[model samples]
Target: ETVNGSEDIDTSMDMLQRQKYHHKRAFEYISQALKIDETQNSEQKEIAINLYQEGINELSRGINIDVWQGTGEKWIKAQRLHDKMQTNLAMAKDRLNFLATGKLSSRRPANLTIMNK
Candidate 1:
């Protein structure tokens, strides 16, 4: 029982690390996408968008895996990471919309406008 319990914790930790990695890579892709003017490099923008979308899919899968079995702290940490990923995903979506329409999204809050930068 002790060994099994330890293994579960290890698996949970690994899942958390994987999720974090995906989130970081997504952020990088989004940053690159933001820097490139879609009019100048539409291909690169599309690639970045695809890469970030892949990352988002990975993060979403990790979130769906119920790995937070033991402590509340683990759950809280996972939730925080999930929230950050959601924010990044939203930014990516907004960027896509902006690039497609050449207009900023009016739905985004004022505070997030600053944070997106």
Candidate 2:
């Protein structure tokens, strides 16, 4: 029983590491997408944002699984970070949409206004 429990923990840890690896890659993609959008086109940026959001969702699920497996603190920290990242990503996407459509209704910092000269 003890050996089986240890093996389960090891498997869980490996899965967690894999999730973290994917999360890091997603973050890199997001950064590259932003840079590309600034100088090239917006399509890649949108694609990257979508990929990042999907990655975030995957990470959230991994964290939930970890919590269910008895890893509480790590799961909680992962969840908190995931929430923050989601909020930031949403704000960024909203800003991008506003720039594309001249519609700030869906933008965050809800009171954001432009002062024109």
Candidate 3:
């Protein structure tokens, strides 16, 4: 009898789920910040920025998990979620810089663009 360590898939899936949870939390913070008047909600903005950064950290960790033995679906899902996290992080950094200096940072390429639609 032989035991194939199939726990890796479970672990990877768990990581992806946790990372998605973090991303959702950050999004909620951003939404809350946006709903408030920016003139009087600096504290909320700061909190949102912090949460976004935390989410980015979690995503970084989650995407780095060893998935060599896991299914391609897990890897694909992780990559897609990681990409979304990057965009969200850029938005967060831009907001933080704007709050601090009244300008958007140019460190990251714009993740968003205007559309004719």
Candidate 4:
């Protein structure tokens, strides 16, 4: 079997690559939101955190669909995306807590503070 001058397998592989690219973009967006949250002042941090968490939750739902209903390759990609999103969510929570209180407990390297010009 062939598709568009490539084997059928290659066509599917191409689609999978596109899907993975979209998934990676979603992860990047979530990470960017977390970075934005980290730079927010105490008064605005709560709202920023809430928004970031919402985006994470939406991404998780999309991942669930991809893992359970998508093709095998997509399922594997979704699983990896989910893991990355989980890490981003944890980082967001840590930043939220730090903003709520004066204590910063994250042992990892500090994230660069995002500044709005």
In the order shown, the candidates' Cα RMSDs to the true structure are 5.8, 6.2, 6.0, 9.4
Model 2 residue 93 lDDT score = 57
**Each prediction's TM-score against the native?**
0.61, 0.51, 0.58, 0.46
lDDT of each structure?
Answer: 0.65, 0.55, 0.59, 0.57
lDDT of 2 at 99: 44
lDDT of 1 by residue, 8-98 (tens): 7787678777777766666666565556644467667667566556655655654565544645677578777777676766666676667
- Which candidate leads in lDDT? 1
* Highest TM-score model number: 1
Per-residue lDDT tens digits of candidate 3, residues 51-72?
Answer: 5455456545544544344456
Each candidate structure's count of clashing pairs = 0, 0, 0, 0
Tell me the lDDT of candidate 3: 0.59
The lDDT-based order of candidates, best leading, equals 1, 3, 4, 2
Clashes counted in candidate 1 amount to 0
- Residue pairs clashing in model 2 are none
- Report how far residue 72 has shifted in candidate 3, in Å: 1.4
Question: Would you list the rank order by TM-score, best first?
Answer: 1, 3, 2, 4
lDDT of 2: 0.55
Q: Which residue pairs overlap in candidate 1's backbone?
A: none
lDDT of 4 at 86: 62
